[model samples]
Target: MQARYYTLNEARAALPVVKALMSQVQEARSEILRLRPEIWPVLQKAAHNGGNAAAGSVYSQFDKLETGVKGILKMGILVKDIDMGLIDFLSIRNGREVYLCWKHGEEDLSFWHDVNAGFGGRQPIDPEDF
Candidate 1:
């Protein structure tokens, strides 16, 4: 998916939605964990019985939940891998965007990188450049 840059306000605007989606992910994770043991045998039997319809349903639900989480993260609400860093505002300029760092270890949003790049590839965001 293409990357979309969001200002501090825009990213913040998504907080409620992101939080809700995160909650859903957590719930789905819990459901999957709870069902694993009981459903494994059933899933195995279903897989062997027909075309794995039962197992496919469970997997599809898991995929949907995972996709939902990624969708929120794609919007710039940095929640995945909290150990990475906190990112506030996101700005795109000259084909790249910078994430305003706002975490315990970073002082500012001075770090940045290409849309497809990860934290390790972040370059310093020049304040004067917008």
Candidate 2:
């Protein structure tokens, strides 16, 4: 499918929903991290025994993480990194397609980069330029 390119205003409008979904994703990720140490032992024990019941919580958090990411993608946003909560929206700038980038803690949509440039290449959004 073709990418959905957002106009500057449209990209701004999508931020709220993206932020909410990112929150959900981050929370689920935190839970997964907290539970990470326990999983290996449980799996090792279950290897000798039958299925382990103790892993349910960790698996459920994975489910939540997947669901939250899907919600963001359903809106046509690119999920760049789950742990960092980075996402990008396709946008047109100077007649070429670039990414309008946002990280989880950012207060507003104010950065963008070339299609090939990752976060390190981020440029500030000029008011007059989309």
Best by TM-score: 2
Measured against the true structure, the TM-scores of the candidates, in listed sequence, are 0.51, 0.90
* lDDT of all predictions: 0.57, 0.88
Report the lDDT tens digits of candidate 1 across residue range 1-130.
Answer: 3445676445546655655665566666666776687669987666556535546656866986677667666775555343332344466655555564433244334455654666666676564554
| Model 1 alpha-carbon miss at residue 129, Å | 10
lDDT of 1 at 122: 67
lDDT, candidate 2, residue 115?
A: 88
In model 2, the Cα lDDT at residue 36 comes to 74
Clashing pairs in 2: none
Cand. 2 Cα-lDDT: 0.88
